[model samples]
Target: MRYSAGHKLETRERLLQSSALSAKRSGFSTVGVDGLMKAIGLSGAAFYSHFSSKDALFSAIVERELGQSLERLSGQGNEDRERLERCLKQYLSMAHVEQPESGCALPTLGAEIARSDVQVREQAEIWICRLQESWAQILQSESLAWAILSQCVGALVVARMLATPDVQRTVLKSSHEEIARQLAVQRAE
Candidate 1:
């Protein structure tokens, strides 16, 4: 009953991807190890082989998700004003508001990350700071980078909180417009 050499790694990846999506859509604390394993078609007993504990899995998920977010939002070395604008538009869009499972982890997982242990929080901070640094390099203002980063995450959280789509859209639109205005001012200065 032996599996291939890659089977373990593949299963681990499947588990991580499934669990991260579940954690994003539902709160991470809400889902149990059995449920997380079940989502990946594995038994709860097998979970220990891939991760020492659920917390370890959580740490891995944060690292994977935030690293991905940094890459997407920051762009490669060629990021310019146009690319940043497009990224912002996508971030503040209705599609992002409706799709928490597939969007940025910050809006969905920020609270959980804040409450997590120091080790987990430190991992999150590393990725978050990397994201801010990339934007700061592009915008040439550390202050502006932090402001826009906070605004974008806050906008997504607020948009997700509203019950109606119209109100949600208004929140997104207002934030996007305000951010654009701020960016223009930064450019002018």
Candidate 2:
């Protein structure tokens, strides 16, 4: 049976969304086209109909995931100092550590993106700059914005790497406290 245009579009979005989360859970390199298609209950042949190649899917997922991150960072989440603090609290929390699939893509897929094709890397760069710009709006310094972002992403990456929850929590706590102190100093000056 032939699917309508809207149905095809909906299927494509489902594939993209599922693949994005799967890639977050397992690096893009580790997820095969067949497995990805199977996860969405589509035959492998249908994948090529929607995407030229696996790399194309990876690129699309990077764009979609990072765009979401940009929205979270730039949107009302960072509206005021209180909101920003609340956002950061949740950002570095244990819950975020436990659920990388539904969380930010940077810490989960940054390394994979670094090794991906130019198109994928470019998508990564674009969203990163968008997020940086958003943070710069609040911090008023591009350098500080990058530093804060780096610390938060690094904290998450390390938290995911270690075997123990205690160490992970410590990483998150230390980074949170350090970032807060740095922000306070920035405000004073």
- Candidate with best lDDT: 1
Question: What ranges in model 1 sit over 4 Å off?
Answer: none
Writing each residue's lDDT as its tens digit, candidate 1 over 69-152 gives 988899475657679889999999999999999999999999999999999999999999999988888899999999999999
lDDT of 2 by residue, 30-131 (tens): 878889999999889899989999988888999999988877766464355666667788889999999999899999999989999887898798889988
TM-score of 1: 0.97
RMSD (CA, angstroms), candidate 2: 1.4
Measured with C-alpha atoms, the lDDT of residue 30 in candidate 2 is: 88
Q: lDDT of all predictions, in order shown?
A: 0.94, 0.88
Model 2: ten consecutive residues of lowest lDDT: 73-82
For candidate 1, which ten residues in a row score worst on lDDT? 75-84
lDDT for model 1, on a 0 to 1 scale?
0.94
lDDT of 2 at 170: 97
